[model samples]
Target: MDFTAILGAWIAVGLTLFILSFLYRDNPLFKIAENLYIGIAIGYIFSITIYNVWIPKIYQPVSNRVFTSLSNWVPWVSKFVTPAGDAGSLTPLFPAIIGISLLTRIFPKISWISRYGFAFIVGYGAGLAIPATVATMFIAQIEGTIQPVFKLASGGAIDLSGPALWTSFSAILLCLGVIVTLFYFFFSLEHGKISKKVTKIGIYFLMVYFGAAFGTTVMGRFALLYGRFFDLYTYRTSGYYHATPILILLVLIFFFVYFGKSRKTSP
Candidate 1:
């Protein structure tokens, strides 16, 4: 293997092990790993903002359209170049300025300037968000709750026909759960024994719902771990992937054991 790839792989694997060391105990090694991870993430975001966002959306447009329009009024440049097609508005500049103005918050005295940026962002974001939120979360949810898979509007009767009649069963259970859960939150009426019983049913449903969500999250993490382990396993047979990482891992382990500060001592 080449030196560069070996060095890179060793660094990656060493860092991985350093992070994994936290499973045993949180030590200086883990702190170093955690900080490095955060720094890399921030650096990555900056690179993306500069290259992908600012360059394409802000710089290129202003340079091509705004500057070109100005340059065309110049005597020699007017003959040499064509102005970009009129985009009809300079709205992009406002957003670019607001984004830049957000940086003023980093300074103590000029931090007040950032509030305009925050206000514009919040107002604009809410303008975009409210309609979508209403449509999806409010209206659509209510529609889903009321619109029955088991009822026929034309006949004005419940259609109890489907595969094993489970559709009707599910619809009935859903309506009951919704009603009972609503009652659980109804503090206007004192929760006597009967109300307490109904609320208990709601609690059971909530537990089941939360359990499913937790299980799904665990499954997702496990799936990702499996994928990474699969790649590691496949690469193990190849020589380039193995020796460097192993050597680096051993060195790191010895260094941490011998020289690093720690509250916990190893057996």
Candidate 2:
């Protein structure tokens, strides 16, 4: 492989070791790695927004219209210039101004100005999201729950096969789960003895749902951990100049030296 490829492998291995050091204890290496991760992520997101959103949506439209001469001078700029056939209005400038206003939050004295930007964002986001959420979640969920009942009703004869029986049982269980879960959240009326029993069933359904969700999340995390470890193992080979092993040794030496000095200095 190329020298740059090897260098990149070494850097990756070193950073991975630095992050893994947190498992032993919270140390300078871990903090350095953590901050680097966050900083890199923010920088990457900003770059993506500038390229994908800012340049395409805002900058290109304004520049193409206002600076038509530059488009002739720079051949590549001509490609991004909005065509005459398309509507090249400067309407996008409003949102651009709102986005800039949000930066005022960084200055304590002028932070109040950021509220306008925030208000627009919140209002627009909620207006867009609420209807979509209701359509996809509430309506879709109700439709799905009652779908099996409709299927059974439409059928002339009852289903007696093993698969059909299983489906029927599942539909009944799902409906029961939904009803009890809704009742569990209904706090207006006092919970009579019967209501308490129904709510207890809801609790069981909720616990099962939460446990499954947690398990899926844990599995996802483990998959990431496995990928990192696999990369580290691959880097330990001679092809990568034993990047993982060398970095591991360096990290171990640094921890011992730094912590040893600190312990010796302390009373």
Candidate 3:
């Protein structure tokens, strides 16, 4: 394999080992890995924002279009007397201006200037989130819960109407159960006799639902762990010296560090 590909594979193995450390116990090694991951992610986001948002949306558009346009000349003069269009076509000055405005919060003299950008960002984010929550999340969940349970026949010979009715009735009950259960936690007032009874029934259904969800989550995690173990076993069988030795060493190191930390912390 090429050096780059080999390096990438090694990094992937290291990351997997770091994540597996959590199965043993929390320690300095896991904390370092987690913090490094967060730092790298933040740096990546900053780089992307500089390239995508600052350059294309704010800088380029403002420098190329807004400067040369005759309509903006009067307002531009009134705002600031500095000559426009002197900077290059893709000048970084506009981004610098906005960045300065954003940094105003660090200085007491111009803290109020940062509020403009913050308000714009907050308003736009809220506007986008509301529609997405309603259309994608809320409606999709309702559709999933209310879906027909029966399978259709190819020849159109058999009637599936009864199964559909049963499915609808079950869905209605499930919806009511969830709603009542949610309402049970909504208030401090003492629940009346009927409310108490309904809430008690709701709790039973909720517990069943939660138990199923927990089972599914556990199964998914176990499946991932099994896959990793399978990879290690397969590599060993194939006589891959690097993968087998590294996997063994990683497990041993993780266990040692985890147990060492646990011993130190335990009373």
What C-alpha lDDT do the candidate models reach, one value each? 0.74, 0.88, 0.70
128-165: candidate 1 lDDT, tens digit per residue: 99999999998987777764556563568655566526
lDDT of 3 by residue, 51-131 (tens): 998767666656555555533655654355343444335345644665568788999988999888777667888999999
Q: Which ranking of candidates, highest lDDT first?
A: 2, 1, 3
Measured against the true structure, the TM-scores of the candidates, in listed sequence, are 0.78, 0.85, 0.61
Candidate 2 similarity to native, TM-score: 0.85
In angstroms, the error of model 2 at 141 is: 0.6
The parts of candidate 1 lying over 4 Å away from their true place are 1-8, 76-91, 149-164, 239-256, 259-267
| lDDT score of residue 20 within candidate 1 | 68
The TM-score that candidate 3 achieves is 0.61
Is candidate 1 or 3 superior in TM-score? Answer: 1
Question: Clash pairs of candidate 3?
Answer: none
Over 4 Å off, model 3: 22-32, 62-102, 131-162, 185-189, 226-241, 250-267
| Order of the predicted models by TM-score, top scorer first | 2, 1, 3
Candidate 1, which ten residues in sequence have the lowest lDDT sum? 258-267
